[model samples]
Target: MDITVAEALVRCLEQEKVEIVFGYPGGAILPVYDALNHTSIRHILVRHEQGAAHAADGYARVTGKVGVCMATSGPGATNLVTGIANAYMDSIPMIIITGQVATSQVGTDAFQEVDITGITLPITKHNFLVKDPAKLPVIVKKAFLIAATGRPGPVLIDLPKDIAQARIKFKYPKTVELTGYKPTYRGHPSMVQQAAGLIMSSERPVIYAGGGVRISNAAPELLQLAETISAPVTHTLMGLGCFPGNHPLFLGMLGLHGTRYANQAVTECDCLIAVGARFDDRVVTKVSGFAPSAKIIHIDIDPAEIGKNVRINLPIVGDVKNVLGAILPLLKKKENGAWVARVQQLKKDYALRYDRGGMLKPQYVLEKLNEFKDDDAIVVTDVGQHQMWAALYMRFKEPRSFLSSGGLGAMGFCLPAAVGAKLGAPHRTVIVVIGDGGIQMTMQELGTAAEQKLPLKIFVLNNQRLGMVRQLQEFYCEKRYFGVDFQFNLDFTALGRLYGMEGYTVETEEQLLEILPRVLTSPEGVIVNCIVDPEENVYPMVLNGSPINEAID
Candidate 1:
């Protein structure tokens, strides 16, 4: 039976089991939008193109599915650039379906026309510009396959308006054959054995795990390896919630703003097993000084990342789950009580403890929040001092519970990400911890949350300044703060009301203790404006050009 290309596209999405699509419609994409209404696939109308992209990214991260998003050509497509780049940087799987100008007008600079595929080429894993209606199913199948396999990333499929309006007999491809594409899943036995030998022999060993552990669902395997060797484990920002935050073997996070003891443990360990983690600069401040005494064993699916940043003593190129599975049998359970005792001593000495200072301290705010929330609650944050504070204070026990822009560190990510997270996991309590400066960047998304009637607990850390940049200026720029302070004092709570949300501001601990619980447990969509101290800063920070172990508290 012949069908419209738009119908073919929608049917293919149903075949892929796509239940939801976040998008914004435009003049060029009206045909696809019309077909969309005939289908059962729920479409979320977003306030801006960026929100759609970010929401999709968040959904993908939580569900481990290929998140789908759509936009019209030209400016609409360009607006998705930031969110797409964010997903690419973090290795999140996403499929972006964009509406394009007619195929004949590809190079004519027609109204609302831009070569979106060309624009996103550098960031996307792969992209397709479809001119033929018959090839729609195949392109979409290929796009999803490429997006979810190997090292995951976003893929784009641009459909021209004329192509969408064309009619053709559609058949979804059973499977795709690509000679150039293959992901290595089974790690070499010899390499796994070598890694096992290092783990069993080393007196003081540490496991440095990253986001890949969560991606491959290798948390159980990671725990098995750590427990078998009686070794302590530290995580990267993206690696949070992979291991229990309160686990005895946990060493908190490592690198800049990382726990002092975790960095010390890495510096002093005789062996280091890096599982599914790339040694980014934030983690390894000075390459020469990172894990200098350790014989590093790197396990990752991506071969290019093996030696891109730090030197590797042993490289195992395979899925973390498969590689860890192979190594578990050869590993011996070690009763290294002395090393365990040492780890305990380090943690005890450097525990995160703060004194009552300013009335509206950010740490105190987060610490109290951690106390009030349940273990299963989801906490999302924007990039700032508030994010660092949340990382230091919140206790995460489950994977995908804590969402943030780890690689990209995008400022205005929390609000839209929280929207996606809540929609994706409706049963879980979703709270967005954002800063005042970051809030204004994409505060328009509040309208979306309100319109959707989403019960979002938005905690705005209102310091009235770009807190991180101000702190940087204090240390490096002779305290000459510029373009950081917000003297106008925009009312966040009032703005939330305009967006049909319940709003409140807490300026003191008394107000917080009385009001925070109400906001956290509130059934309605609400925004809590927390008036925090402007002078606050994230501590245990490494000075520029310093070793990871050398940090200034």
Candidate 2:
């Protein structure tokens, strides 16, 4: 039976197990939207195209599935750029489908016409411009496959209006094979053996894990390797929940705004075994001073990333889980108890601290939030001081429990992300901790949550300023604060109520402590506006040109 390419596209999505698509409707994509009206696949109408992309990204992180998002041509497609870049930089799996002008209008700059595939070429892992109706099914399948495999990232499909409306016989492929792309899953046997030998010979070693650990589901293997080798573990911002935050051997996050002890341990370690982490500049604050004495063994699925950012002594290109699984059995337990003790001492000596007796400090709110958070609760964060506080104080014991815009450091991520996360993991509690500045960026998503009747806990740290920017100005510009303060700070609780959700405002620690638990249990969507101290700063910050070990509080 012949069906419109739009209908065939929907069939492909169904085959891919795409239960939802976050999108906005426009003229160019009318046929697709019209087709979607009859399908079981739910479409979430976002207030903005950017929200749609972020919602899909949030869904991907929590569910470990390739997220789907769509938008029309021109401004609609361009609006998805920031969110697409966020997914690309963080190595998220997402499939973005955008409608383009009709094939007849190609290169003439028709109404609402723009080269989205060209615009997004640099950011996407791969992208396609579909000019033929017959190839729609294959292209859709390929897009999802490319997005979900081989160091996952966003892939885009630009469907011209005429092709989407054209007729095609629908037949979704059972499997896809991209001839030019095949990722290595297992590490070379010799490399695995070499890793085991290095573990046996090293006395002082640390495991630097990253987002890849969570992506590969290698936490158990990572734990076994750490335990067998008696190594402490530290992670990047994107790697928050790859290991249990409360583990004794855990050294917290490493790099800028990292724990002082974690950075110190990295500085002094003899062997740095890196798994599934890219040595991003933020993680290597001063390249010359980073891991100066360590014999670095970098393990990642992407060979290009092995030496792209920082020099490595050994490079193993394979899936983190598979490589660790191979190496774990060969590894013998070492008696590096003394090194473990030293790492623990460092953690204890330079523990994360903040004002406990203050008016609703951000850190205190996060600590209190930790108490109410279930082990399985998904905590999403927008960028800035609140994100840092969550990183420092929240106890994450499972992968996907902590999701944020790590690489892009996007400000307006949490609120809309929480909506998609709740939909993705319907049974789990989803909490979005955002700052005043970030919340205002996408606070309009509150209406989406209310419409969906999602019971998300939205916590806003109302500092009345862009906290991170203010902190930077204090250090760099002699404390002459500029453009960061919200002079007309709106009441977030009132805004939530306006969106038909429950709302509350807490001015003190005691007031927040009493309300947070109940807020977490709210049956309908709710928002809590906590007035936090503006003077507070995220401590243990590694300043510019400073080594990761020496931080300023």
Candidate 3:
């Protein structure tokens, strides 16, 4: 049967079992929007193109599925760039579709035209510009496959207006075969044995886990390996929630703004087993000083990341779960009693602390949030001091319960992301912890949540300043803080009410304690404007040219 390419595209999406799509309508993509009206797929109308992309990203992180988002040409397509980069850096699977000018206006710069495929080349795992109507189904298939497979990332498809209106007989491909694109799932036998040997022989071993552990769903294997070898575990920012937060062996997050004990343990360990983690500059701090005495055993799916940033004594290139499973049987259990005691001592000595009596603090709010929320609740945070604070205070017992813009550190991510996360996991309680500066960046998303009637607990830590940058200026620029403080503000409580939701203002501990229970248990969406101390900053920060262990409070 013959059908318009736009209709064929929708059919292809249905074939992929896509239940929802986040997008906004525009002139160039009118045909696709018209075709969507006939399908059962739910489409979420976002306030801006960037919100659509971010929402899709959040959806993918929680569901472990390829998230789909769309936008029209030119400015609309350009707006998706930040979100696309965010997904790419974090290895989230996503498919981004953008409308383009008709083929007839190829190089003439027609209305709402831009080379989106070309612009996103450096970031995307793969992208396509569809010129043939018959190939639309196959292109969609390949895009999804590429985005979800082997170190997942964003893939884009540019559909010209003329092609969307063209007629074609659509047949979705049963399987895709891409030459020279096979992912390595199993580690080399010799390398796996060598890694086991290192684990068994070392007296003091520490496991440094990263986002790949969560991406490959290797949390169970990671836990087993850690327990089997009796190694203390420390995680990167993205690796949070992959390991149980309350476990005795867990050293908490390690890196900039990381825990002091985690950094000290990593620095002092004799054998460092880096599972599915890259030696990012933020984590390594002083490259020469990182794991200075440890024999580094690196395991990752992407071979290129093996020796890119740090020297590795042993490299096992394969899936994290597979590699860990292979190495487990080769080793006998060892009781590193002294090493465990040493790490525990460090944990106790540098425990996280804050003033109990003072103005309302962001840390205090997060700790209270942790106490009140369910263990399985999902927390999404925007970048800044609050992000670091949330990472420090929230306790995550399961994987996929925490989501944030780790590598890109994009602001304005929490609100829209919370929207998509709630839609993806309707049974789970979703909360948003965003800073005052970040919330204003995409606060318009409140309308989307209101329309969907999502019961989200949004806590805006209103410090009335860009706290992170101000802290940096305080340290680096000799206390010359400028362009960081906000002179004016909006009534966030009233803003939530304007969207037909419940709102509250919390300035003191009494107010917070009184209102939190009501807001958290509310059936309707609610936003709490928390007035935190303006001068408060994230502690245990690593200064320039200093090793992670030498961080200052």
Report the C-alpha lDDT of model 1 over 1-553, residue by residue, as the tens digit: 8989988999999999988898999977888899999688989888999999998988888888888999999988999999999998889999999999998888999999999999999989899999778889999899889999888999999999999999999999999887898989889888888888888889999999999998998999999999999999999988988889889999988999898999989998989999999999999999999999999999999999999999999999999999999999998899678888898899998787666676599998898998898788899999989998888888788889889898889988888888888888888899889999988988888878887788888889999999999999998999999999998878988988888778999999999899878887878777889998888878889888999999877
Q: Give the number of colliding residue pairs in candidate 1.
A: 0
Candidate 3 residue runs with Cα over 4 Å from true position: none
What RMSD, rounded to one decimal, does every model reach?
1.1, 1.1, 1.0
Model 2 per-residue lDDT tens digits across residues 1-553: 9999999999999999999999999989988998999788999998889999999999999999999999999999999999999999999999999999999997899999999999999999999999889998888888888898879999999999999999998999877778998988889889888888887888899999999999999999998888788899999988888888888888889999999999999999989999999999989999999999988999999999988988998888899999999989998888698888898899889988887675778898899999988889999999998998889888899889998999999888888888889989999999889999999898788878888888888889998999999999999899999999988988888888898878899989779878877888877777899998999999989999999998986
The parts of candidate 1 lying over 4 Å away from their true place are none
In model 2, the Cα lDDT at residue 232 comes to 93
Off by over 4 Å in 2: none
Candidate 1 vs candidate 3: the TM-score winner is 3
Give one digit per residue, the lDDT tens place, for model 3 in 329-443: 9989888999999999999999988776678998999999998888889999999999999998888988899999998999988888888899999889898999889999988
lDDT of 3 at 409: 93
List the global CA lDDT of all models. Answer: 0.89, 0.90, 0.92
- TM-score for predicted model 1 compared with the true structure: 0.98
